[model samples]
Target: MKILHLETSSRNCSVSISEGKTLLSTCEEISESLNQSEKLHRFVEWALEGASLTLRDLDVISLGKGPGSYTGLRIGASAAKGFCFGLELPLVASESIATLAHPFLGKEYDVVIPLIDARRMEVYTAAYDGATGKVLEPTTNKILSENTFEKYQGKKILFVGDGAKKAQELLVQQDSTFLSEVYPSSRYLVDPAVERITLQQFEDVAYFEPFYLKDFHGVKKTK
Candidate 1:
């Protein structure tokens, strides 16, 4: 089952090709400018070319449905839908936060909290069980503070993703580890996407939309 994955919910523009749980290739760029709109197509082509496959060779399209950047998620969804439509393939999607935590799950930490910088002092995040990769806290846009993860204090927690840097300073936990360099990547979507495909949990390509928990709010006009 050759799959093409697109994850563009954060600053990173990521694309990958996978065969079931095995990753074949990835093309990613972490730009502060959030230029995913400019790089998504090229990344997709790069991933496919690197994997020595073409659009027609893909069996499914998996995407990072988001609670991150609205524009970035839209860019990724458009590209995924275009590919799925063009190739007549099925679409599988995963939460952007979960995708960021996938690679770190079941590692050393007892809990994993994946965070996406939501500008200012707020972050889009969720807590996952490190051992079983289960959600401990549902996705939310949290305003950072020393008491952010108050309930999970004293546990060995691993905070990951772009917003982890913000969390490191504010989330007061002596046992916490922070990996701020991590970002949601298409490669991590492989296993969950494959499982969804196996269970026929595919999205309706024609009507699918990114999981934006909130509406976009652009800069207000100043007169």
Candidate 2:
């Protein structure tokens, strides 16, 4: 199956095309100036063009439904919905945390935490059991603090996401493995998206929406 994946849940905007287990193409840009609205379609076009395929040729459209930037999520969802509607393809809504956790799947660790920046020292986070690859109940609202990971002390935790950098200093003393370098990308969504498509796990294109953990709060006006 040919899958086109879109990710715009963080600072980076990315798109990828994959056929079964083989990645055909991927494009990414990390500039804040080039976010979902500005670069998402371009990236998609580039990825498809590079792979010598068109949107109509895709079997499914998948996206990173987020707990990241509200604007970015909206843009991604809008684009995914548009493509799904236009091409009559199934829509797969993959969670941003799951995308962040994609790279570490199959690795053995006590716990895996995928965090996305929620601004003002808060993060949208969820815990996953590395051994079973299952998300734990009650996704968290993690506030950055000096001893944030104290509760998980003695357990080896691997942290990955955009918020990992900020959490690194606070979690320094804990028995933690920081994967601050990993960024959310469409490549991470492809395999899971493909699996979902194969299993017919899809969302209603007309009503599916990105999972924005909270309402958007832009910079306040200064009078």
By TM-score, the best candidate is 1
Writing each residue's lDDT as its tens digit, candidate 2 over 98-201 gives: 77876786787778888887877998888888778887644567788977766667877888987888888666555678876666888988777877877989
| C-alpha TM-scores of all predictions | 0.95, 0.89
Q: For model 2, what is the alpha-carbon lDDT of residue 185?
A: 88
Global lDDT scores for all candidate models: 0.89, 0.82
Q: What is the lDDT of residue 118 in candidate 2?
A: 83
Task: Compose the digit string of candidate 1's lDDT tens values, residues 94-156.
Answer: 988888888888788899998889889999999999999888999999899999788998799
Model 1: CA > 4 A from native: none
The numbered model that scores best in lDDT is: 1
The residue pairs in collision within model 2 are: none
* CA RMSD (A), model 2: 2.1
